[model samples]
Target chain A: MRTLFAAISGGLFGTGLMLSGMTDTRKVQGWLDVFGNWDPTLAFVMGGAILPMAVAWALTRDRSPLLGGSFPAAPDPRLGHNLVVGSVLFGMGWGLVGLCPGPAMASLSYGGPSVWIFTLAMLGGMLLAPGVRTRLDVMASAA
Target chain B: MPMDWIYGLAGGLLIGLAAAVFLLANGRIMGASGIIGGLVDGTGRSNAAERLAFLGGLVGVPMVIALLMGFVPDGAVTANPLLLGAAGLLVGVGTRLANGCTSGHGVCGISRLSLRGIVATCFYIAAGGLTVVLFRHVLGVI
Candidate 1:
């Protein structure tokens, strides 16, 4: 049942990515290209997504999930180095490729070898990140 | 008033609704990187099946849609292999290090008013814009 729900959600999410033009690298880069031809469609996508999500959070506030597990607790509010630095790096990559995780997955069917290369590289990075993060944490503590 | 914006908005709503369902049904955040990352990194062995299921749907449903609709979604990924590899590595490491991606932080976190989510979103967007300015405008390498 849990798995089924997850699959349903993932399907919906992918469909949304396709319809929103997120699957298009050109469109995504255009949005980020503030100095060049800027595209504002993504702004609407962001805004539209936030509306229902805000309400979902509200609904979840007092109610438990239908499934057995508990809702995720509030995240730590501190602006940690991991959050900032990782995001900056992620952003740079996003700018370079105009493909974030969700759209990257959505595009796999027709995205060809380039998509495969990017996905494999991204997976390799994911595999390496934990070690790098641990090293960074140690460095931070030592300094 | 462009059709693309309308499509974007409608798609955004669907994405939000997907998040809501995931939250309401499973009580978990629907973060793509986190889900896939956990699987690759071996930290999420307990819920591996669940993760794979989500991923399967994420990958599968679109194929079905494209087949039935007869329109392939264009990703327009860069043909440059080096750029693609570099970007992929950065995205992979960065998302794992940060513990979320655009879906997790941008939509779900911001909607919930989580400070981490908001901060992450701001920094990433700023960084992405700067990269575009540097690479596309100044360097023109990518």
Candidate 2:
């Protein structure tokens, strides 16, 4: 049943967040401190993640998505100023905040009440995404 | 054993499994960046809904699990709020510009071995490395 799958999936996902230390911004900040004491845990975690991910991608790329049902994979729109600008900003933000979308989503599993603050910021960020994209694109177009 | 480490592993397993299943059933790569990007371009509403659901699961289900398990993170604790806000905004902008994020380029794109994804990933890694160096070494935030 979809209900059973959903419940089970939710549990596993939450558990992963908690185990990965993503819930702790301190750990994240420490990891990002590349030249300063450089916690290497994130490396192992990202490494652990690659295996299953690779399996899934290889198996799934040619078929239709079960939930989305055969949605077409589009060609890359590639190569423009947006790429350069966006990546730079993303890196800057990650360097400063110690959390990005993936880790931020995972941190919610830690369950302290303040996690909500991070969540709100994340949602707010996501919502503002379109507008920001448009502005950047417009800037690119004019430039 | 640190509590957070254990929890993070569990979380990664969950995402991996879900990603696997989504791949099997939907035949879609679970690249949050790409899915989210498509929503912006209006090329994939269906992709958009699934992405929303996936994101919702990423954020909500974790807390729900913690609630049921009776082990909540302390204090709803967070870092510098302004820093997080700025970070999130910048990430949004960056993801838009890159045409994907770690999930898209790092996970899905890498899996496919796409040249573009490789280039994007390289850029992301380089930028992240430089940013870390800049913040800690050049700027001395650390």
Candidate 3:
């Protein structure tokens, strides 16, 4: 039942990403191109997504989740070095190719060689990150 | 003419609904990077099946939709392979390190009023914005 719900959610999310034109790298790049021909469509997408999610948070604030387990704890707000460095790196990559994991995976059917290569490389990077994170953690504690 | 904003809004709503569903039904945040990362790093071994199920749906549904609708975006195919690979690597590493992405941080986090999510979103977007300026306007490399 849980897995089924997860699949349904993932399917819906992927469909949403496709329908929103987020699969279009050019459009995503255009949105980020503030000084150039800035497209405001992604903003609308973000705004629309936030409304229901906000309501969901409000509705589920006090109760345990409907399916069974306790709701996730609130995210920690500490200013960590990993967070800053990672975000900056991610941003540069996003700028280079407007393919984040969600969109990249969703576009696989049609995305050809470039997408394949990107996905493979992304997985490699993911595989390597744990080691890097451990080192960063050690450095952080030492400082 | 493309109903760009309308599509974006409608799609965004669906995305939110998906997030809400995952949260309500599974008691988990619908973060792609985190979900996939956990699997990769063996951090989510306990919930491996659930994560795979979610991803299967994420990719499977789109495959069917694209097949049925013949919806293929042409612009994505032309990217330089090397750059594409490099970008993917950065995204994978960065999202894991940061612990969220657009869906998790931008939508779920902000909606839940999580300061970490908000801060992460702001910084990544700002960095993304700066990257664009440097690449497109100043360097003209991309």
Best by lDDT: 1
Q: Give the TM-score of candidate 2.
A: 0.76
* Cα lDDT tens digits for candidate 1, B35-139: 999999999899998889889989999989888888753536788999999999999999998989999999999998899999999999999999999999899
Model 1, A79-123: lDDT tens per residue? 788888899889999999898899889878867678788899999
- Candidate 3's DockQ: 0.79
lDDT (0-100) at residue A138 of candidate 3? 97
Stretches of candidate 1 off by over 4 Å are B72-75
Question: Model 2 over residues B1-142: C-alpha lDDT tens digits?
Answer: 3454454455455557765665565555556555545655565674455556666666677666667888645542345567556666677667766767765666566666666666776776667667777766897753
Chain A TM-scores, per candidate, are 0.96, 0.76, 0.93
CAPRI classification of candidate 1: high
Question: Which one wins on DockQ?
Answer: 1
Off by over 4 Å in 3: none
RMSD of each: 1.3, 4.0, 1.4
Give the B-chain TM-score of model 3: 0.94
* Per-residue error (Å), model 3, residue A10: 0.4
lDDT of 1 at B133: 91
Interface RMSD (one decimal) of model 3 = 1.2
Docking class of 3: medium
Candidate 1 C-alpha error for residue A64, in Å: 0.9
Candidate 1: give the TM-score of chain A. Answer: 0.96
